[model samples]
Target: MLPWIQLATAKVPGGGELRLMRRGEEFSIRLDANELMNSRLGGSEEALATLACQKLAGRPRPRVLVGGLGMGFTLRAALKVFGTDATIEVAELVPEVIDWGRGEMAGLYGDSLTDPRVSILQRDVGELIRAGAGRYDAILLDVDNGPEGLSRPANDQLYDSRGLSDARAALRGGGVLAVWSSGPDDSFTKRLRRSDFVVNEVPVRAVGKRTGSRHWIWLAVKT
Candidate 1:
C-alpha cells in the first residue's frame, strides 16, 4: 500500500484549513484529521445531481447552481445529464479546491470545467443564493458534512431558516434544492417544510452501491 501524499493546502473562510491528499490514484480533501470528500466515494454526490436534474429534465435551457465543487463530481454528473442548452454555475468558497480540480486532479474533472455550459465562481455559494431571485432551475448544495457546519462555521447559514428562505426565493417556481448530508437531521427536514418546500429525504450509499455507509440527500422543491 502507498502512503498518502499531501498535494496542497488552503485556508477556510471562517476558520481551519483544508488539505488535499493523494494516495496512489485516489484523491481526498480533508479538514484537519477528518476527510471531507474522496475521489472514490462519489456515489451520493453524483446522486445529488442526478436526482435534481431528473426534476428539471423537461425544462428547456435549465439553469442550475451547485454550491460546492468537491472534486467536480457533482458538476461532472450534472454536465452528463444536462444538454448544451443547460447552464451550470458552480460556487466554491475554497479556491484551492477549484485549483486542485484543474491541477492535480484534472483527470478526475476532465472537460467538465471547460464545458461551455459550466461557469465557475470562486466565492461562497450562500452569497450567490442571496444575490439571486428566481434565477435557477435547481440548487445543489454539498458544501458541509450536513446541515451542520463541519469545515467552515459560516456554512451553517446555508441551512438555517433565513438561508433556506433565501434559497427558496432564489429558485424559479418548482426548482429543486438538493442537499447532501452525512446523516439525517429531523429539524432540518421540518425547517424545509416550514419554508414552503416539498421535501423528500433520500438515503443513498457513499459509493452508490450498498457497501458503504448510508448518506442522506434532501430534495426540497419550492412550492
Candidate 2:
C-alpha cells in the first residue's frame, strides 16, 4: 500500500483544519478529515470548466463562478474561453489547494490565478452561491464526485434538493449552471428539472482529444 501523509495548513469551514494526503504519487485535498479533491483520477474537474466555457460561445464579457480550484484546469479553461473583460470567481474551501496550485502545480496552472479577471475565494461554494444574488451568467460546479458525494460528506448537501434550488437562485435569468460528474446521474437530472432548470445532459471524452472514457455534464439553464 502507498503511504499517505497529511499536510498541515489553515483551518476550514465547520470548524476544523485543512490537510493534503498523498497516496502513492497522487495528491488529495482534504478539509479537516474530509477529502475535497483527488488529482489521480478526477478529470471531470477540467471537463466541466471546459464544457461550460464552450457553451458560452462568443459572449464578450461573461461572468462565471467556478466551485473548486482543484488542479486549476477549470480556471485555465475559463481563461481560454473568455477575454480580458470577463470575470471569474473561484470558490475553494481549502487554502492548501490554492497553495498547491501556486507551488507544486504551477506548470499546469501557469499563472491563471494571476489573471486580472480571476478572483480566488477561500470560502464554500454554497456561501458563494447564496451570496451571488443572481449575478453570474454562468456557474460551473466541479466540487463532488457527482450526486453521490464521494469526496466529502458535506458535499452531499451541494447535490441535494435544497442545494440545487440555491444554485438556481444564484444564476441570472437564462444563465447556465454546469455540473461535472464522474458518471451518469439520472436522479440528479430529475432534481434539476424539479428545480425549474431546463436540464441538458452532455457526454464528453476524458481527454480533450477524441476517444477516451466518457464523462457526463449536466447543463441546467434558468428559465
Candidate 3:
C-alpha cells in the first residue's frame, strides 16, 4: 500500500489548518484531524449541484453561487447541467484549495475552473450571500461538515437564522438553496422551513453508488 503523502497545507480563515494529502492516485483534504473531502467520494457533493440545477432547469441564464470549491466536484456537476449562458460564482475562503485544484489535483477539476461561465471568488461565501438580494438562481453550500462549524466558528452563521434569511433573500423567487452535509440535522431542517423555504432532505451516497456512507442534502426552495 502506498503511504499517504502530504502535498500542501493552507490556513483556514478564523483558525485551524487544512492539509492536502495524497495516497497513490487518491487525494484527501483534511481540516486538522478530520477529513473534509476525499477525491474518491464525491457523490453527495455532485448531488448538491445536480439536485439544485434540476429545480432551476428551464430558467434562462441561471446564476449559481457555490459556497465551497471542494475538489471542484460540485462546480463540475453544475457546469454539466448548465449551458453556455449560465453563470456560476464559486466562493472559496482558502486560496490554496484553488491552487491544489489547479496544481496537484488539476485533473480532478478538469477545465471546470477555466470555463467561461464560472467566476472564482477567493472570499467567504457568507459575505457573497449577504452582498446582494435576489442575485442568484441557485445557492449551493458545502462549507462545513454540516450546519455547525468545524474549521471556522464563523461558518455557524451561514446555517443560523440570519444566514438562512440572507440566503433566502439572495435567491430569486422559487430559486433553490442546496446544502451538502456529512449527516442530517432535524433542527436545521426546521429552521429552513421557518425561513420560508420549501425544504426537501435527500439522502445520497458518498461514492455515488448504492453502497457507501449516506450523506444528506437539503434542497430548499425560496417560497
Would you estimate the TM-scores of all the predictions? 0.98, 0.82, 0.98
Q: Pick the winner on lDDT between candidates 2 and 3.
A: 3
**Descending-lDDT candidate ranking:** 3, 1, 2
Taking all chains together, the TM-score of candidate 2 against the true structure is 0.82
Q: After superposition, how far is residue 59 of candidate 2 from its true place, in Å?
A: 2.8
lDDT of 3: 0.92
Model 2: residue 198 alpha-carbon error in angstroms? 1.1
Where does model 3 exceed 4 Å of error? Answer: none
Q: Pick the candidate with the highest lDDT.
A: 3
Worst 10 residues of 2 by lDDT: 7-16
Q: Which pairs clash inside model 2?
A: none
lDDT tens readout by residue for model 3, 119-179: 9999999999999698999999999888977889999999999999999999999999999
Query: On residues 111-158, what C-alpha lDDT tens digit does candidate 1 reach at each position?
Result: 999998989999889999999999999999998898988988889999
